[model samples]
Target chain A: MELFLLSNGKLSGEAELLGYAKRQLLAMIERRNITSAVFVPYAMIRGDYDQRAGELSQTLGIKVTSIHHAESPAEAIAQAECILVSGGNTWMLNQMLHENGLIVPIQRAVREREVPYVGWSAGCNVATPSIRTTNDMPVRNSVVLPALGLFPVQINPHYIDAHISGHMGETRDERLAEFCAVNPSESVVALREGSLLHVCGNDLRYFSAREQGFKVFRHGAETREYQDTSALRSLVPFTCH
Target chain B: MELFLLSNGKLSGEAELLGYAKRQLLAMIERRNITSAVFVPYAMIRGDYDQRAGELSQTLGIKVTSIHHAESPAEAIAQAECILVSGGNTWMLNQMLHENGLIVPIQRAVREREVPYVGWSAGCNVATPSIRTTNDMPVRNSVVLPALGLFPVQINPHYIDAHISGHMGETRDERLAEFCAVNPSESVVALREGSLLHVCGNDLRYFSAREQGFKVFRHGAETREYQDTSALRSLVPFTCH
Candidate 1:
């Protein structure tokens, strides 16, 4: 099993989508001899699905087709050699994944077939056990908190420590702390804007475009930052870089 | 119904909680002859309920007690003269309101008894028909998007235009826009920090501790900013000040 879960699609000052980790992504795609992949763009609330597919195709030098074009989204997931999920609204994305009946197929494909999976932002959120740590608003009337549990531990994508001055809303850290407080047993991997977690079989690796480390949050404990994935080895299935 | 929906409890440089609107709150308490109020502190994830109640008691110069002390929360709402909700997590607050059978009782109190309602942040979100516009994370396992429906329209409290540099996550404006895009018929009132919307019967007024206006968002229409509540008259039942 292989996975590339990114914090976001594009970082500030980067011209291309997934520009920060283009080399890593390209290496994975070429190593597998992948020619084409299915793109899940349900999380994209404001972007064009086909255009995003085209961008990935250009960046990865492989054919990337949106799942919307397929007659059966589940069948598309089952038949795909690789899966690429885009970042956008988590609520809408998760709802769509459930509504279209692709959760099981995607899970089966990734878990059993070992199809390579790539996701960022909302895309990365659905890979977790639940959407509890997502930062997006619940825009829909009906909401389902449970998501695809591809990744065992919860991950808060696009995580940041900065705050907007004069805004009294809870900071990102405060929100994650509340999550930890409520789900004391669960841990959250707080990924910054340019960070990505790469999982291969039983091994996991962490990368940051800005040369910084990610932070791990737990209940009743001070949040500790890490420059490598060594700390996550004991928590989940992964080896320290 | 008399209501004071605050964007947040406290703002920068403010010495006391709800200090920005202390005079307005005092006026309402005195005018309504509200001797004591029931404080709903379910949204408060980390703070003590008694401490919050005590703070309000000091600020409003009236007897304020946390509702958790009551054997039946719904019974407490039925007997209360006023209701005060704190700011913390909106999902937990709305979920508790439904699970503890306090929604209808509180609605009856606010609608029939005309009990003055005061809420900040998550409190403000629950007053709306749904919690879709809330900015808090849905940390709980079971979530109910439908709220008390006291306020006819949805409100996004603690709204800010400021953005942390290099953060790629959706901005406050962008999130609201996505909400509008999904729920085309629905509208969102973005309240800035230290701002509030006061409802007195059919008349509604806007107040800002920092002397700032609020932004109104609707699908297909221009996102407009207004200094007063006059613009909200046509959207919902509120006599603009």
Candidate 2:
């Protein structure tokens, strides 16, 4: 299985979507000799699906077809060389994936067929066990907390330590702490912006476009940030050394 | 029917929990000759319930009891003179409210018995028709989106226009816009920190310690900020004028 789960789609100055992960994406595309990829834009509430696919095509130099146009989205996933998901509303995206019957097909493509899967933000959120760690608002009534369990651990994508001064709401750290308190046994991977977790077979690696580190949060253990993948050694089915 | 739906609990310079709305709260308490108020601390994950009730007691000059100690929580709500809900997590609060059968009791108290309902942050989110407009993370697995319809329209509490530099995630405005887009006919009131919406019998009013205006969002209509209550005229039941 090959997965590129990014913390976010774009960086500060980068204009293109997935600009931070460009080199890795291009290299992966070239190595696999992939001709086309299917784009999952269901999570995008305020975005144009075709425009997003067009941007990805221009960036990756590969044919990117939005799955929404397909009469059979599951068939699109079954025959795709790679899968790309947009970063938008997680709740809507997960619900649409379930409603459209694409969850199992995408999972089969990535797990059994070994088609590469790339998702950022909300897309990266569904790659995990559940969407419990997402930061997006629950803008819809029909909410589905569970997502594709392609990645074993729960991930908090677009994690940040910065807080707006005088904002009385709970900070990001506090929210994650609350999550840890509720789900004591589960651990969360705090993926900061510009970071991506690449999973290839049993070999899982972490990369950052800004040379920044990622943080691991657990119930009782102290949350520590790491500059390399060595800190993720405890994760299941991965040798981080 | 009396309600004080606060955007948040505390402000920057304010030491007490409900310091900003102190005078108004005291005036209402004295006017009604209320003896005691029940504090609903279910939303508070990290904070102590008893301590919160104690703080409210000192601040409001009324006996405050945390409802967690009651043998039957619904009974506590039934016999309460007022309900004060704390601000921590909206998801957990809404779920617990539904699970413990406090929704109808609180609704009866506020709607029939004329019990004053005071809620901040998560509490404020639950006052609306649903919890979809809340800004908190959905940490709990058994999620409940619906809430007591004490307020007819949806509300986004702790609403701020400030954006962290370099953050690529959706802004507060964008999130509310998505909500409006998805639920086209519905409206959202974005309440900034230190602001509140007070519903007293048929007369509804708005207040802000920071003297800031609240923004109203609709599907295709332009989002406009207003210091007066005239903008909320179209909302159901409530006479915003």
Query: Could you give me the TM-score of model 1 versus the true structure?
Result: 0.99
Candidate 1 lDDT, B163-215, residue by residue in tens: 88999999989999999999999899999999999999999999988898899
Task: Estimate, for each residue in B101-192, the C-alpha lDDT of model 2 and write its tens digit.
Answer: 99999999999999999999999999999999988888999898889999999999999999999888899999999999999989999999
DockQ of each: 0.91, 0.86
Candidate 2 scores a C-alpha RMSD against the true structure in Å of 0.9
Which pairs of residues clash in candidate 2, taking residues 3 or more apart in a chain or in different chains?
Answer: none
Which predicted model would earn the best DockQ? 1
Clashing pairs in 1: none
Q: Lowest summed lDDT over 10 consecutive residues: which window, candidate 2 chain A?
A: A232-241
Candidates in order, TM-scores: namely 0.99, 0.99
Which stretches in model 2 have alpha-carbon errors above 4 Å? none
